[model samples]
Target: MTTATTGDTTPTPRSRLLPQGVGVIADVAAVAALLAGGGRPIVWAGSLGAVLAGSYLLVRRLGQPVDRTAVVGLVVAVVGAGIFGYALRPSPPAGPAQQTTATPHSTDPTAGSPTPGATTNSTAPGATAGSPTPGASAADTPAETWLADVAAVDGGEGWRHGAATVAGTEHPRSVIGSTCSSTHDGHESFNLARRYSRFRSTIGMPDDAPNDAHTRFRVLVDRKVLFQQDLRLGQTATVDVGVRNGLRLTLEVDSIGTTSCGDTAVWGGAVLRR
Candidate 1:
């Protein structure tokens, strides 16, 4: 008598369960990686999945047993793929950084107030004369006074004292200087008390001035002319006059022709340096 053997070596349900669960988890992770900007993570996940699947098929074809070791490897691979996908995920764009600036404290009690005897017929609303320009630092320069700060004693005809625009540039401290006619000149006088050494300014026509606008600017110390220039539209002059030991400072603007139509002069950044 002889004994016969059967070749029914199918894997048990318990043995297949772990690998199937791990495979499902890997597929889910790959889908997630694809949804979250599929770049290197998708490629890595697909490659690992293909390798593990191929190994499983090869083992099956060779009639080898699907053991606990194989299931553990599948679990490890899935876990690693998940970690890699998470690591390689795209990040959000960074926002602009916030900035903080501190304003310097002023030592002079009267720093922002208008100087005594400084007068203007009309001032722009919220105008502060004799004050340092916005963003100006007291420690940056010597003690100084702006011509726009002092009140005019003799004349301010057609002159508006405050911040104004000239040649498309904004002057934080300036005077809109103008004149009515060639004969009747517009002027502004300040009692300097012989305190300042130099007067400095940039003179130009407003950007909106007519093309034919023409005028002459004069700086006088104690009724004596120090600097004079004729300017037309788009022309600018830098005035630097020595006013040491001078009692009065005057700025005058007159028309070049008969009438001063469309003449909008700007005395920009006019200041006296000590």
Candidate 2:
């Protein structure tokens, strides 16, 4: 008995994908969007969709005799990848930086002032001014006056060790840091007089400061210690000097351990407030 067999012509798993033409449209759109300087959303969506569609087309048509969709899709993916990488590359480091924010002041005619001859200013949200008393919290600034920045005050002295103002674009307060040698030991002073109320500052090391920086930062109000402690990189110690004792403010920096190897100290920014 002789058996005759017929050939089977069923499509295999690895055969050309059904939506061959869809990939072409996706690739073109993605490349066009990328080349047109499109923003993140459009570029990302286009590129991602193009990559998946293009890859599927390329793989399915790998052994096909003559199909331009696979090659074109592959090119679009590569080009899209290159464009995406370039567009998302990190920006260069910014130059020597300075950043500061304004202390929003209230605009009420009947608002109370800090002191008789002293001016006042509004603070961040939730600030209320109270009448001056024997023990007034710096937080209880009066509504009528504007609090002045430390650098803007008069008789501010004693950054003998070395002082520099760093304005942080995003920080609420400007940063006043030291530019002194490793073994720095000195006092910086600011006289608020009767013009300002809340006198305060924070002791900290600058961002990206050396690991070996060791500092004993101190804040003194009228010869009385408000805050005194050791400060390290990325550590913040706050000092609050009320307007009742707002006559004077001083900053003391001393390297405690390791001889101040990277002892760069910062104490005040918007130091005097209301």
Model 2 regions more than 4 Å off: 1-175, 179-185, 259-262
* lDDT per residue as tens, model 1, 40-159: 655666655644654553455354465664555555455555555665667656555544457555558678865554443334423544543344333432356667776777877667
Per-prediction TM-score, please?
Answer: 0.48, 0.38
Estimate the TM-score for candidate 1: 0.48
Determine which window of 10 residues in candidate 2 has minimal summed lDDT: 144-153
Report the number of the highest-TM-score candidate: 1
lDDT of 2 by residue, 73-120 (tens): 676667556655655667556665644557556567787764354544
The C-alpha stretches of model 1 lying farther than 4 A from their native spots are: 1-142, 182-185
Q: Pick the candidate with the highest lDDT.
A: 1
CA shift of 61, model 2, Å: 99
